[model samples]
Structure formats: structure tokens, C-alpha cells
Target: MKADGEALVFYENGERVGTVPLAPLSRVFMRGDVTVSSSLLGKLGERGIGVVVLSGRKAVPTMLLGRPHNDAARRVAQYRLSLDPDFCLRFSRAIVEAKLRAQAAFLGERRESEPRSRYLLTLSLKRLSSSITAVDQQATIASLRGVEGAGAAAYFEGFADLLPERLHFCGRNRRPPRDPVNAVLSLGYTLLHAETVLALYGSGPTPSSASIMRSTSHANRWPVTWSSHCGWRSTSMH
Candidate 1:
């Protein structure tokens, strides 16, 4: 692929294939073996367009983030906020609460649509509500994570009820998803995570500064965090 003025020109077997306007594009996803020029990468970075490359069957992703907001002071402040324990705790509580609420709403909708799953959904909803309430009571990040994990466990129970029996989905499992439902959910969550990082980079905050209720991966060490509240509503709903 090559950048031609304001567009990306595609080629195949030494023949021109198609053209896509770079202006309308926010991010680019390239699978295994796809290649592009360094000049195009620079152009994309200049336009705040992130490029994510996925390689191999596992689809391990490597991201070339766009140029972030130029406000150095803003980034500094964000870094400071990330380090503040009180702020992180408060922010994490809010994030977990929003995630649980979204889960509850999704389960409630499932209950309405699938009468046969109402019992399971109702139980999950109640569990989520309790977790939401407990979010305020948590003092440390570890405890908050526990609350979130329990809520997610309950939420997945309801999610399992919505899937077809053929999928044989009991609960959330990943890193080698044993079932179809888990596989799709894992893929959706991975995409959501990429989008979240892009959004954060676009807004000038370092995605690594996203230290609230998230861990640093040993592989790339790109401090990854997902907008799980939005994920439950946008991803799980579909």
C-alpha cells in the first residue's frame, strides 16, 4: 500500500486495486503479511490515524499510535492524576459502577426478550446491583478489582443464557477460548481495547497513564485499559 496525496492507494500483483480517502479514516487494521511504506506511516501519524498490525494465528497486535494532543501540560496533569491513589480509587469505583450498571441493563433486556432465561438473568441482575453498591465500600484497588470480577462473573452467567445452546457457553474464558461464544466475546473485547487506546491517544493522554484498575502486560508493557462500561453496552448488547 502507498499514500498518494490525501488517499491510500492499494495494489495487488503489481496492479492497482482501490483507493481509500485517508481523511475519513481514524485507524487502520492490517492482518498478517500486509505491508505499507514508512512514508505512509508518517502521513497517517500526522493525521492522528493509528495503525494496528495483527500477526499470526493468535493475532497478537502491535499498535503505532497517532500523534497525541500537543498540550504537554495536559499530559503532565493526567500523569499526576494517575499517580494519585485517592483519585485512582475514586475513578476506579465509578468505572466499575458504570460497568456493572451496563451489565445489569443488558441482562434486564435479555430477561425481557428471552422469557426462558429470566430466572438466570434476574439472579445476575441482583448480583450486579449488589456489586455496584459494594463499589463504594471498597478501600483498595485490589478489593475494587475483586468486586468487579464478581460482578463480571455474574454478568457472564446472564450472557451465557442469551447464547444458543449449541455454543455450549457456560462462562467467560479466554486466552484460548474453549467455546464459540467466548471466542467472539474475546475478539470483540480486543477490538474494543484497541479503540479505547486510540481514543486515549487522540485526546493527548498517554494510554500508559491509564493505570486505574488495569495491569501492565508482560509482553508489550503497554498499560492497557478497556472502557468496559461502554463495552458491555456496545459489545455485549449486539
Candidate 2:
């Protein structure tokens, strides 16, 4: 958790209990009640080090989460997750199914049989689908270039506007920490994009891709928060 980058910490009941990787490890395993402060965790994550939070039994990793992500495979996986042509088709079918269920839910009341709700739902679904496709396209076309990194960013514009207003919405109320749908998509794909970016951060001879990665990560922890992908935070710059 220290900037030492040489330290691997584990805590027991808030007490710093031990360390590991006798050598400087590129990875760290935070197990049990091992206590490391969030600052250390953020530093580790910033360095692109992998952090694995374990479950109670130690055998089951209840949270196999990524810190700042360091994989390139996620790019390809995201394309699949981005909802291609098949996704559009399936989404449409889901709308129809939802509408039918909606009608059935109201059958006992013998109401006016309004299709407005269904129509709005379907329309919202289409718009949401379009937004998703746009984000996917952006991710697909993006390269390591400064300008290019954001070429695909536009596809996910105005993401803050889409979320279920009825639910608790993650303790945000009128102004939620983040919209559920947007939060899922942002956290999911950004992790993939960041991993790809991190792997290229300092692994090259020429400054081309690596320099761009450094600049991007420094300017903004895009992998962490795409909202400011161009941020120039000194901490994440490295």
C-alpha cells in the first residue's frame, strides 16, 4: 500500500499483519482482514497492479475485481458485450415480451388498455440501444492515438440521462452517484479499455503508444473514469 511499490501488505482486524512477494511483485493479493488503507489500494491500482479481494473461506474469491486493469483481451470481449446486430434483435423481442407482460399485469382491472406506456418503453429501449451501439463503435475504432482514443468516446454521449428514476438509484436520489445502466456500462467497458491502455503504457521502445498511454492516464484515469479521460492528474500520470 506504500509508494515503495516494494510493499505487499495484508491486515488482520485493521492491523498491518504481513507482507509478501519477497521480490517486487507486479501483483498483490489482499486476503483476509488484511488492512491496507484505500490510499495504498489506489496507488496499487494506479500502477496497474492486479488486486484480488478474497472471500471469507479464502478459497472462494467473492470479489475478483481489477484495480486499473491490465488486459488487452477485454477489448475483444467488450465487442461481444457491446450488443451487436443480434443484440438489437433480442432487445426488440424483449420489448415485445415486456409489453405483453405489462398488458397481462393489468388484465384484471379492465382498464382503457393503453399502449402509451408500452410505446414509451419501446421507444426508450430503442434509444438506449442506439446509445450502446454508438459506444461500441467508438471503442472498436479507437486506437492509441491522442485524438483517436476519443473518436469512439462520442458514441456514449449524455449517458447521465439514462437510468431508472423509480428505484433507490444507488443512494443518489435526484442526483445519484451514477445511473445504474451507465454505471454498469462505464465500469465494465472502461475497465477493458483501461487494461488495454495500461499494457501499452511503458512496454515499448518508441514513445508512440506508450507516451500516449502515459499522457492519457495522467490527464485522466480513463480506465477509472472516462468522464475525464484527458485529465492530467499527477498521481495517475505515471
Off by over 4 Å in 2: 2-7, 12-177, 205-238
Cα lDDT tens digits for candidate 2, 92-115: 333323332332233212223434
The window of 10 residues in a row where model 2 has the poorest summed lDDT is 204-213
Write down the lDDT of every candidate, Cα atoms only: 0.78, 0.36
Question: Model 2: how large is the Cα RMSD against the reference?
Answer: 14.6
Clashes of each: 0, 8
Which lDDT tens digits does candidate 1 get at residues 1-238? 8999999999888898999999999999988677799999999999999998877665667888988888888889988987888988888788878878877887888799899999988998899899989999999878988998999899888888888899999997877788887777766766666777788778777666554436524312445344323434334536
lDDT of 2 at 8: 62
TM-score of 2: 0.27
Clashing pairs in 1: none
Error of 1 at 191 (Å): 1.5
Worst 10 residues of 1 by lDDT: 216-225
Error of 1 at 214 (Å): 4.7
